[model samples]
Target: MKLKTTLFLLFSILGFSQQNNPASTDSIKKTNIFKLGEVIVTNHQNQETTNRVTSKTMESQNKMEVSRALNLLPGINLTASGSRNESMVTIRGFDLRQVPVYMDGIPVYVPYDGYVDLARFTTFDLAAITVSKGFSSIIYGPNSLGGAINLVSRKPTKKFEFDGSLGLIDTDGQRSNLNIGTNLGKFYVQGGLSYLDRKYYQMSKDFVPMKNEDGKERDNLYRTDQKVSIKIGWTPNKNSEYALGYINQKGEKGNPVYAGSDTQNSLLARPRYWQWPNWDKESIYFISNTHLNDKNNFKTRLYYDKFKNLLISYDDANYTSITKPYAFQSFYDDYTYGANLEYESRFIPKNTLKFAVQFKEDVHRENNAGEPVRRFDDQTITIGLEDIYKVTAKFTVIPGVSYNSRENKQAQDYNSTTKAISDYPNAGKSEALNAQIGLFYQFTELQKLGASVSQKTRFATIKDRYSYRMGTAIPNPDLKPETALNYELNYNVQFFGKLNFQTAIFYSSLTNVILSISNVEPGKSQMQNFGEAEYKGIEAQLSYTPIQKLIITANYTYLERKNITNPAVHFTDVPNTKVIGTVEYAPLEALKLIANTEFNSSRYSTSYGISVPDYTLLNGFVSTKVLKYVSIDAGINNISDRNYSLVEGYPEEGRNFFVTVRFFNSN
Candidate 1:
């Protein structure tokens, strides 16, 4: 299969390249940062880049989740999950929770369920994003079965620097970010603050009302978020450094519910009743690194994180009625503390050996209305080792192994007025062994081929074990860990010296898949390991420098997910196809124009086959440096005014505009 895919991709890209004029390789840098597509691989870590969104593009565009920064990459899709402010990032047909998120190589996903709300991660100080998918290194911890995303923050390189920006958008939304930093030779300090205010926004004119609800969407649907970040660093020598960093964010956003009856082909069944009153997060981390010598290196990291959220609702279907006042005001809190250490041995000429050890503990507690708190603790330990062996000048092989031990501790608050608690010790303990093998062969200076096979496993979350799914699905505490065996083949080529073409074909067989299924009768659900499943996909990216001043890039993904046991007629929560294209033109050195479009096919939210309407968004932005230290940006999103929603009944903003002004100085 890999050989067929390689040959097909080679012939296809080579034939396509013959249609374009020859240009310089330097002009083929990625469009988002360096230019559109250049392939660069790291020999030390065995990491490679297929695409990246440069800081320059991020600086000019409207900032949101880190997911938004990589939307153009193939097989990467963003879906509206629980609420408008909550988004789920799906990679290669995998659920959002199956993928792990990282910041500067530190895990940030809530330890209880390994879920991270991308909306809360505003792009305030981000420098770059790296996506490492299947066949990833063994050191990235557990629960990264599908993929991992790393958000890298920027560090000031100059002696003194200051940057600030303010943006205004439609629907009374406004935002501002301020940053200041300095590199004082021995000790350095940096910090940034961000504020965003969002009020009710409008939908497309073509939208059709459902469940007799007004076509005008909802009222008081607004959001406000703020962030603060600080970092301090000390450099005692050229090859060693120690740093500490802190981040805090708080916000509240209304959640829209599905109206009327989605089970009966009704797009809008339920009405919007509950809204997230407050969502807050805080993080502090310390990083230390030193090079013992040229052949060996050592690094360590420590981090602590806290997350809090509030959900509440009251009143009835109409404004004049009050049926369930003070119905519920729930508070959820989670705390995590973790430490990791890594050692790299390069004693051999062409072999790089890496060993990693990590420990993490998560304490999660929640209060119902005004009741006592129910707490759960999750503990984990992982040890991993890998070696990248360079067999020849053009051939490389990587083999790795990891062992993970996870234990869950549970305690529940009494239902009565008494404030006593009952504790259950060691509710679940799961241990797994995973391994992987990968090979990269440089067929030629302009062409490369890579293939890998991996075995991965993920443990169940606390909620997935004990809590009922909002009175619908019953949770079973004895659920087993989900596991998968993945295979992938990759081909990359540079054509005409100005075009970068890359393609990958991947397949996975997943077992012990946790899902909600029929309990015994109708209208009831139970969480269970339903059956085995298969997933396969093809992703391709083509970047061309048609001219020195004009660049074009396009990416597409085709995915198929099948339930081997059930043989269902529809695929739930997964889009079959995703596509993105971009055009960046610089008519003048100081003036530039950019445009991109994203497309997603229909997606089903349930086994019953109700789906969210497909959508195509057209966006464009123009930026100009009008002054030596000042720049201006303006853009329009969803320019086509297409009435659509990523999640059923939760309409997205339509035809919105934003403008920003930035002031920065590095000297």
Candidate 2:
């Protein structure tokens, strides 16, 4: 459907729904979300600059993956790495390496590249996902140059609870998940398991044939993922609590070949036959919160995370044969261990003070076919202090500062010509200081205005400073950290009991950006801190419950990014404009209908000027309660069957259908 037609239909439905009978309210209680992982800031008027996506929202939209779920929020855009077949999201034009990801307050990004494939993170076990924008809390530790995303797990508050779902996608795809938990006053336990698999996906009928692809089912479009999670908690008293958690995820996927017309002599556009035989991660963590006295509280978190993956490249589309020069196998084994300690005190009246210290160590080991393993190690430390002071009944001030340092303990250099390995020279060390302040004014009970400015820094990842890029790049261990100064103004207001609106204007100035400079040596590039950039954006969100039976929500974002040092170099993958709208209507208590639409403006696919065309998508779903304890949902995504690509050559799935049945019982 056309964008204009879709919007008209949405509003037409809203107009027709006004005459319908009121729908009954749902009785399901709010799921218990873990609070220990949250960054505590001033609670004045609850104006902290954080957005959240609850489990209910994920279920309503059928967003089974973290990346897709996050896209529902303003200022966040979903993107794909076609060559790697990995899903990612950018926040206000910043990539995942700068935004970072966390599970229960522990960093989960890959230690080497500082990125995690969000598609591999299933949403079945999460209670909520929280995103903090530019003005993030300093207590989150280092590397939050853009923002932070935290996945909050569920905690059992009832004696017995169970939730499970089984789903079928297209014809061959399948998905299933189960979550069970129990609480016994002082002790509680929760566990979850989820699996998703798909053999192939069909392309839109309008998709034109290319050298590497034709109409119908796309080649090598298969994926499988499985995850298991468990947590145990003990509450000794009202003032003390402890928890231990474990999570494991396993996945495998194939990369479809390039299907665009830019294939003449351009290596970047060449088709690739790539597959990931193994993509796995595991994490174990312990967290504790204790109240020292009426004036103070302390918290601690300790975690160990491991990641392993294997990539195989073939010369052609054939399933076998790796004898060609472009064919090879790569493997990575990485791990990280970290600890955080925080103390909060309210000894001074009308003031809250927080102190936090964090330590982390990362190790990366990798090798190619017939090559010896190369290893790298690094250590990081951060100390932060923040205070929330109430200046008056309607005014609040929050100020924070953090000191961060990183040291490269060991790095191995491999010489392809000699087949020899040696220690890398000039082991790098770096330090940075970050500070931020926010001012908030509560003009009235239903209106608030806030402003904030922050200075953040991100250290170069191990790969950034030392990767040879398969002989195409030189290792520059002396690369400095990248920094960004951010400014934002936000307003929140409620016009009526059913209407709410929020808006923000944000700007960021980036300096010493890490960019790959060509021809540092003959035919080789080097990563250096040599670029400057600016990102400015405006975001607005609105929600209205016209009546008890109908609700409508919409969000829009406009972003502009400029390369100050090189005007010719364009920012890739992030759309200049994005809009999303959703409508939920319940004509009956047991039955509901939902429709959603999304639009994205054209975006650069490569720094060399290639662009992906703009597109709009429409989706619809029907949900109904069957038995007293069961519910069923049927949905169709990309109702228009329009052919669209986030990246230049990678077309997304089209006109897909899904059916899900859920069972739940809580007491």
Candidate 3:
């Protein structure tokens, strides 16, 4: 017998006994304490949820990447058991690609595939990372079916401010970052630069690779990167502001050597001779806002991005075999243009309304042997509106709707050697209409309840409808947009002002699901609208402080996924249950310690008869202020060294250590 959930629904009923009077003093102190599954956006206070909207000591976390930091949230998983290129953040059994990333209100994703590499984004210049799960705000543009994630950058208000850090890892790696900003009365300037050099990380002692691929440690897994960015802003008055920004980034990484077993061996070829030669990006943008009064306000953003990636495939294992050792190069380029404009009004009492329009276009080019093989464009236009109505002092309602239009233009696929076009070309147009409604009620000073029902639609990506998927899948320009009808319910309870518990349950019905299955030929798949899916899950988080300087938190999620079109089969990448626990303790005024534990249930890949068993991991961190301007941070990841694989053949790195020395000004 197998257990589907850790704890049954009884925990929901038991929470009622813990509700108590609200604590005003402790509430202010809790403002900087980042709680699990808590919304941290700085938007207007709404009746849907209540908590601190800002953090004063966000820099204390010493986060290198956003993926690991976000893993602490309920229902958010950084599962390593999949392809490294896949989005690391999974929400309620939905792929992260379905969750869009917004930077200062601009959506950012790979125009060709709709994937965002969360690990490549550093947290050095972030003000906060805001996440909105099911029934998210309508202001976020299209392709946000599962939810939305926003990386809010910082704004400088001082004459001069600078923050920098340098870190060293036991795995022969180094990381350095610098951020500086200044305010010149009416004008402001800010800039940041970061660099990372890392080598192959060691695995746990318990992990042992196959005979031929075995080494003292993981092989051919190293990365080097550099990034630079600048932003200039003008603030004429308290109610108006304008800004311009530019960013350039470059990266080179080696794919891990693929170890194979007798049962399966797809990884045996590419991992041995191919590597990413270049991954580069350039972006320039402008943003402006005007706040005339509560009755009228406006904001707009315009941006252009250029992305280039290259993969080099070698003809020989030694890479330098004396006999005409040549290599082949494949290139992908995307030139993207996007703009967004929004208007808000409050002409009626007890009501707030918002309207927005957005435009986006991606011109893509694929080249092999220094010759163009494919050229296409993806474009979209959207209009949306939402209103918040206060029906009573303790009750509120929100309703929203959006219309989207998308088209693919000038798509052509031709052979590099013969210059002959493929018989089947991809070009099409599509449209979708989405709507949602939400309710929030404050039952008491210490408790609240919220629920929402929404229908969301996500458009197809360029690769989703065009790419061959390396011979495993064929192109299909007729693929339709995927849609999901989501239902959500949540409850919040507070105890003695120092403890809090939040629980949520959600169900989603997905239709016209686009999937790649064996339709083109035996053992091969084609992109098509082939299946229907349903997902339901329950999640809960607890935050409590037993003492003045210590805090402990825990969260868990139980999920069920049904392939409505085929109930006997299960999805390949999701786990059945997950639990996370953490402790933060400060024994001295200048010292702080943090520890965390993560557990995931086994996963089954039905098509391949592969099962990755359950596993648990532990990590620890310690930080101390050594001087007025300096702090030291040291930590060890995978302290328990339980050898495991999130994605089969791609084992998790073993115990590793890192130390950082940070510097900043008092102002």
TM-score of each: 0.89, 0.94, 0.89
lDDT of each residue in 18-42, candidate 2, tens digit only: 2323221123326467666565565
Candidate 3 lDDT by residue in tens digits, 160-205: 6555667787758887777677778779887888877778888778
User: Better model by TM-score, 1 or 2?
Assistant: 2
By TM-score: ranked, best first: 2, 1, 3
Q: Clashes in model 3: which pairs?
A: 81-646, 81-647, 203-654
RMSD after CA superposition, every candidate:
9.9, 6.8, 9.7
- lDDT of each residue in 193-279, candidate 1, tens digit only: 887777777767776666634556445567888899888888788777788989898988876555324656432443446677788
What ranking emerges by lDDT with the best candidate at the front? 2, 1, 3
How high is the CA lDDT of each candidate model? 0.73, 0.87, 0.72
Worst 10 residues of 3 by lDDT: 1-10
Q: What lDDT score goes with residue 54 in model 3? A: 27
Candidate 2: segments with Cα more than 4 A from true spot? 1-29, 43-50, 264-270
After superposition, the stretches of candidate 1 with alpha carbons farther than 4 Å from their true spots are 1-51, 82-85, 217-220, 259-272, 317-326, 413-420, 520-523
Best by lDDT: 2
Query: Model 2, 573: alpha-carbon shift in Å?
Result: 0.7
